[model samples]
Target: MMESYLELKKRHQKEVNEFPFGFAFSPAQFVEMMRKWGLDYEKDINKIVSIGNGGYVQKKDRDNMHEMFSRHRKEIRDFISADESGEEFVYKMFLREMRNYGYGWTGDPKDTLEALGLTWEDVQNNEKLLNGFNKASEVALRKVI
Candidate 1:
């Protein structure tokens, strides 16, 4: 009585392909949009896509941040290495301000800090930390912000 996943997927694809208005989306995207917002596939496509405008932009921004970070990862890390807490500051800033800028935080504070390859006392009295961080931020977020 119930369709298999493949059958349902095929049907959804067919529906998405046949829909004639607004924008076009793949079946998987359509299904994800529907599932994320709790809507029916037949009736809610346009509504969800319309409401998804902000989500789409957010996704694009997040993706761009990731790409930029990846491209400049070594430079960012090198700059943040100026201070023991440099990486931590960036991590927390991303969490609070950027929300999903994708700065590669490990979720564990100790591990994240340790990844910086600095000891606790290594940063004591270090004065170039802020300058390094500023340069790093400029490099890392040049395209993002």
Candidate 2:
């Protein structure tokens, strides 16, 4: 199961790295990926809730995360409003958020991406970007675990 998750993670990372501008995954795709990884989505969701309760995100980091999420949302909205295809805008937004907040999905990013018509690959690339995303994700995972 861990290996499957790792494989999915790697695939997601590759997609992000390759596109860095497209971030769309249908709900089915997202859920299927999770299922394929042997994760019970509900359990993971509960784990996230537990992590929040545990407070490992820290007040400061939580505030920072909110700020980051807000900024990314605004950026995406502005980008979308500027004459691009909704899909393109969405893909950019997904990449932006994943690039900034990390891409653990938890479902939010994937939903947002689907709404905007982007894919995971659209927003992931560059050694620095991937490293940063993974680092953030690792932190989140550590908190949850």
Candidate 3:
């Protein structure tokens, strides 16, 4: 089941990379996505929380959060590598990471672009489009989690 979930996650990550922007996912959408990934929310939530809370820092269970972020990064990297979308995959991967790891206003487009080796100017140039994409992903994430 874990392998199946991982495989499904890999496939979705690939799809996310290939497309990068434009898809609007909701909480229901995410639940469906998870289902497709072979993940059972009831069974996996605690594990996800545990993984998400792991970190090197010590502050209100910061380590656990850091650990989750670390796991998420690894998963993102694996998915990005398997993506067939070429260079665009990197951008898409960053966006996905931002949505998953970034919280509140910190999930800005500039931050996401910088994380992807892009400059603010690059994001500024494509502001309208990226904002839409980011909003869509964020909304979907909020609904699912």
What Cα-based lDDT does every candidate model obtain?
0.42, 0.42, 0.47
Question: For each candidate, what TM-score against the reference?
Answer: 0.21, 0.26, 0.27
Worst 10 residues of 1 by lDDT: 91-100
| Regions of model 1 farther than 4 Å from truth | 1-25, 50-130, 133-145
For candidate 1, the clash count comes to 0
What does candidate 3's lDDT look like per residue over 1-145, in tens digits?
1223245457656744543121114656545544654556466544322213231112334454456556656765554445444224443454464665563345455555555555666544654435534554566457556
Winner on TM-score (1 vs 3): 3
Please say which candidate is ahead in lDDT: 2 or 3. Answer: 3
Superposition TM-score, candidate 1 onto the true structure? 0.21
Best by lDDT: 3
Candidate 1, residue 74: how far the Cα is off, in Å:
25
List model 2 lDDT by residue over 1-145, tens digit each.
1222234345545643543121115656545544654555566433222123222222323455566556645554454445233333333333445444444536245653454445457536333334433454555445445
Assess the local accuracy of residue 98 in candidate 2 as a C-alpha lDDT between 0 and 100: 47
Candidate 2 error regions (>4 Å): 1-55, 84-145
Rate residue 84 of model 1 by lDDT: 55
In candidate 1, which residue pairs clash?
none
